[model samples]
Target: MKEIRQQKKQPEVIRKRILEQATILVSQKGISGVSIQNIATAVGITKGGVFHHFPNKKNLIEEMFNQIILDLDQTVEYLIKRDQTEYGKFTRAYIHSSFIHQIDGVVSAWSALSMTMITEPTFNKIWMEWLKNRLSQHAETDSHPDLELLRLAADGLWLQSITGVIDDEQCSKLEDDLLNRTYLT
Candidate 1:
């Protein structure tokens, strides 16, 4: 039973490693520069081994996106649940989640890579669909003009931070300001 459990765990471990390496490579080299062979080489696995888990580069990108979305969803859900007020709850969670992903070392790499991925046509669509669904779900509470402005501001701040146009100190202040704005809405 232990041996069988190890066998089951190994594939999952490799798949995760592939996604990690792919994120790093894509962030450093841009989307066009990374390939299945590049990911395999980084993971110290054969091309066929990477292919065994991901049939192509697109599949790998999509899987990476899925993982990112899942993380964001969980973070937002947790933050929303902890909040007592319904007003602007989703927008507050979004701003907090954005800053968390940006500053938190665990997901900082993904922050940079996600900016790149969002530019890709397919990934862009996937991201937009996710945003649309989330917004629709929270329309009753998050549809206010003030909340919408705060959300857009948070997005702009996120873009500025990733592009190096906004320094860490300034970003923190702006993030705090946005969170405070959510309370007013």
Candidate 2:
């Protein structure tokens, strides 16, 4: 009975540690390089312990992606409360929150997972459908052509920033321009 109780508690403890370490590693390095052994070492645990909780790398990746989706959903909620217009909410939330500092490993994990999704048929379908639904929610049919152009520009800037292709200054400038076009102007 005592051994069984300890074993049950051990899995939760190991999983928490693995996730914390994995999040840091993924944010710092991106997903391609993260490994069960590496996460285990980072957490000062054994590979078997990591596997006990995750079973495989795919599960870990999925968990991380799910967390990201949850974070994005929370951000959307915050934006909805702060801004009345759909464009304003999206612009403000995307520009301000998307590029916040995270572990290099976590960022790398996200990048690798994203690349995988690009080629995987099921993931690609789901991602495209999600994007379409999200875009539809904010897209306006009667906006000026210039406003539409600006929205695309903002999206490009956000994508670049998320991929680590743009520096903070450039991202800030893009955010300011997006805010100006979407609200001030």
Candidate 3:
């Protein structure tokens, strides 16, 4: 009965499930490796059902990228609002978002986002615009090279975790190092 109830969800709820399953599939295999059939199978839906949500693979990828950016923005906002100190908020925000997102599977869909960023104009534009805006947001740290380095720490940790170069233990330790060195003190 529970399984029947679960399978009888609305189209929109099922669509969200498809997107999440697609993201997990994308994380394991690059964009090219994920087919509509794979997403449908993961979501326990028909290929036609998947297409009902996303017209095609490119459209799915585009939606995934946008969802990633939205999630990142929310993470940053959460960290900034928590600190309320106005000092090193950007650094903490970046570190926190990167570490949490990586560990908590929020960025699973973005494992190979670089390919999208480099090959897709809209992805590149939105990413660059976000970076530029974030830089401006931390005006106080604009002249400080350490802040710049902190940004790299976030990116490096993200890549290392996403690419499976480091285990979770090492990733957590590195995340701690970035926090202790940058803001936690």
Local distance difference test scores for all models: 0.80, 0.62, 0.74
State the TM-score for model 1. 0.85
Instruction: For candidate 3, give the lDDT of residue 159.
Output: 86
When 1 and 3 are scored with TM-score, the better candidate is 1
Can you list the residue pairs that collide in candidate 1? none
Residue-pair clashes, model 1: 0
Of candidates 2 and 1, the better by TM-score: 1
List the candidates ranked by lDDT, beginning with the highest.
Answer: 1, 3, 2
> What's every prediction's RMSD, in angstroms?
3.9, 5.0, 3.8
| Candidate 3 overall lDDT versus native | 0.74
Off by over 4 Å in 1: 1-9, 102-118
lDDT: which is higher, 1 or 2?
Answer: 1
Global lDDT for candidate 2?
0.62
Residue 3 CA error for candidate 1 (Å)?
16
Off by over 4 Å in 3: 1-9, 102-115, 118-122, 141-143
Q: What is the lDDT of residue 39 in candidate 1?
A: 89
Instruction: State residue 30's C-alpha deviation in candidate 3, in Å.
Output: 1.4
Candidates sorted by TM-score, best first: 1, 3, 2
Candidate 1, residues 78-172, lDDT tens digits: the string is 99999998999999999888878632254454464465565576677777788889999999999999998898898889879877999989999
